[model samples]
Target: MDAHLRELRYFVAAAEESTVTAAAARLFVSQPALSKQLRALERRLGFDLFDRGPRGLALTSQGSALLPVAREVLALWDRGYAEARAAAHPHQLVVGMQTAVGRDLQRPAVERFRARFPSWTVSLRLVGWDDPTAGLADGTSDVAFVWLPTAADLATRVLISEPRWVALPTAHPLADRAEIPFELLLDEPFVALPSAAGPLRDFWLAVADRPRPPVIAAEATAADEVLELVTAGVGIALLAEGNTDLYQRPGLTCRPVPNLPPAQLAVACRPDEPRKEVHHFITCVQP
Candidate 1:
């Protein structure tokens, strides 16, 4: 077998990042060098690893299958390498959330994590992109608040499920209507998230039943960008009911939609590499 751990590491990084450039940046290597090594690995393995798209790279079925094994090997290696440091150094737990979760579930959870692990550093990170785990696959974050159907195969726990709502221009015709119907907003232009956002972008675009491709007037990676686009009449956006207050912007108004399932928020981590700190934080969440 020509299998090399270095090749596995590079392949996993490229797969998770879904782009050679991103993987290179994360791995601290030149893009061409990363590409060269990836091609060599593919040649050695005798299978294609990624499908290069205009937006970025996407994992092939074979690539997806290899990802978990690669992760397990890396985690085992980390455990062995970290054993000495873990004993002498203060343990630190990094947690990531898609948004600033300020509800009762999150507040007490933080407090409890701090009280329980006084010697450990607990850091809460607000993540903006669809990959809210912020490299959790590579062991960067111990836990993350992410949307369901994220990455297709990560282990997750649902935190909140709230109905989806639309943010429209204040002067929109449907502004007077208390609740806008999905049919009414079908033809309207929408602000879309980056393609890398995966299922999350599709959810926000209401892509399930549209007859024609949605008109993407702008691309937003954060809540503020969504509101800015909506206020400027560039496009409308869909969000969870709880986020209506958060994305509130001048000249933009949020209204309920008649029919659509609410977005589901989740806390996710690698299934195989369970950590004590991750459980402590998740257990603290009341609901």
Candidate 2:
């Protein structure tokens, strides 16, 4: 019986970490979940992968033998997947974005890209905020329009740098102001991005600008959800200035926060990306 790629991945992680707890942490899954997958893989192979111990797990002889093979298989699969994407979709460049890049950037850039590569096409994928890289990490996007401070492995060029603004319900007292002081809104409950968003979440929460941690009213995974939450009076949220016009609704009001550092929107791609078309798209988006 053939083991699944996911099972092999789990096995490799478990073998390397030497403990289900460590493996789960490394994989961003629960211990029980990782343990269950490992047991399932063992059952499929009709052998135990690890010998349980009080201190930690020890790989069985079979497990140790299989570890390197599994690692090689996973590496080969990654290479094959990347190759397939390039070969199968050479003319289509996928651009992932978390929100509407409404600074009149998308249209002109895509037009320029199309003009440059007459045979090529662009696919704009709207990804959620949970993936701050906008699908670059997983190879779903050839290039992404992502907020600044993304993964270090990816390269970025800042296309838009604008002041961060606050979104509030129309009825909120702060909504009436033309501009709100950063400190004045510091105490209000804030709608935050998912913790999976990492540094991007902290940026939106103004974590560095605050005296203490923000009081998170709720977590939102998308720009629309954040706007909806603010409109429903769940909590206020911070946004890039370019998004204000795109997300504007009757019940939501946006006010600039002059003291806060501006949010930067960039075109990001894997630094090692082989496709010249991807780099061309980045150049098209550059200010």
Candidate 3:
């Protein structure tokens, strides 16, 4: 059974990444090699683990049942490993996030964090937007910063709550307006977050039961992509206030939308796993 630990690691990576090529890149192995290992693992277990579809990998029943058990085993192993190495080396903190944190917020925060924990190193991982928790629930990040309305299971700390705005092409009729009401933008098509973002997606769409309905022109998981689509006339979207600074392009214009409820930016972590390191980092970023 111990021999399968490596297989478990491979399986978990493949499952989390949802594609052989992506999992291989993360694991630092060739794509073909990763595919072979996955196939072998399936044969050894005598069942299919993933359903390869147009939408990418979806776990089979057996895979879903085995996932939590495998995570438990990995967590136990990691704890033991950390204990064994704590005396010999400095600790490392891995932070996961979906959006661009920007130099204004991250620079001072990281410098202060390093000064506070002089011996520790930090790794900022850009997790995809598919999981609203931004890797916190999966244990990939010690802590994560993401838009609010994440999974209820994870703990959260609100960093910033700002009014929403709309981004559209300069060619848009309302581009010259100083401020636009939320009602006016509802009937227009807009770029939206992927469905996997859960409530975060719904919140950004501002889908109230008004007569107007959301016409999603395209789905985007990153800010730059959404902005690009916006400028290309794909659609307009409601954006957080901070996005005005994060995305500044010649073809785009951002205007405050006075009526929509604001979005909150927050730091999230698993409630079951809290540490001083995470607490300190939170302090450094707090407004």
Candidate 4:
């Protein structure tokens, strides 16, 4: 049986928002109308897509399984639409990165893209944590070096898995240790990302299973702030192990966490507005 693309789109939106009312607002439809369409789609598919409960709508196993397929279909369509738009008019491709991207693993790929599209000018923008996606939402940059768990709407290609390391003040008791346990950090006051970061803030806080709130001594938007705060004894911060040398202070030291997983570094772009230059850049970065 052929599935309606609109239905799949609505279902995915609802799943991502986790509330029909929110999904309705996002899709610019009335709640009752959206609900009716969802019901109709479920019947057509012969499966219950979500578990409606007091907390909100939770995806069933079937719905979770369908999510990636839906995203892939949408992504391919979006890429085609972007390619068409780029073909009609020439435009600059602005790339943003949090650090000096000269040493980036994708440099070789970028060189190849330049050889193929010599007429396109690729400009690089230095971005801070203030806007991790480097203005992808507002079109400041066509694409960016971003961390994952970003705005769910952006499509990305992961570049590296540089794991997290904790920076401790030299005077602190744990500074002498070669490594620290993740559990030890549970009790310490931590430096946090800006509140505007939303889900990103929570991810940096490592709050997935935190029962009680944490003590936040400071908020950092860049490596300098992270070092300044940690050195002044304001709070400790977790950062990529590779960045340890970048932010070292006279009174600061870095050590790995025994059990925490690595953080993903990636190149991100708006899936809905992929530019040809961005597509070529993504192609260069892809392994």
| lDDT, candidates in the order shown | 0.76, 0.86, 0.79, 0.75
Q: Name every residue pair that clashes in candidate 3.
A: none
Who wins the lDDT comparison?
2
Residue pairs with backbone atoms closer than 3 Å in model 4 (clashes) = none
How far residue 276's Cα lies from its native spot in candidate 1, in Å, is 1.6
- Candidate 1, clashing residue pairs? 162-262, 163-262
Model 2 segments more than 4 A misplaced = 1-80
Window of ten residues with lowest summed lDDT in model 3: 81-90
* Candidate 1: C-alpha RMSD after superposition: 5.0
Q: Which candidate leads in TM-score? A: 2
Better of 2 and 4 by lDDT: 2
Better of 1 and 4 by lDDT: 1
Q: Worst 10-residue stretch by lDDT in candidate 2?
A: 74-83
Writing each residue's lDDT as its tens digit, candidate 1 over 1-287 gives 56787888889878877888767755667899999999998898888888888998988988888889888887677555444344554487777776656546667887888898887787777666545455464455667777665754577889889888899999988888889888888788898876556677787787885777788888776777778889988998888888887666678888998678778887776675446877778777766
True-structure RMSD, every candidate: 5.0, 5.3, 5.7, 8.1
When summed lDDT is taken over every stretch of 10 residues in candidate 4, the lowest stretch is: 98-107
What is the clash count for each candidate, in the order shown? 2, 0, 0, 0
Q: Over the stretch 1-287, how does candidate 2's per-residue lDDT look in tens digits? A: 89898898888878766878767754668999988888888988999989999978898899889998998898667656766887898899889999988777888889999999999988999999877888876678888989987644688888878999999999999888999999998889999987567678889999999998899999888999999999999999999887888988989999999889899998998877888888988888747
What's model 3's overall lDDT?
0.79
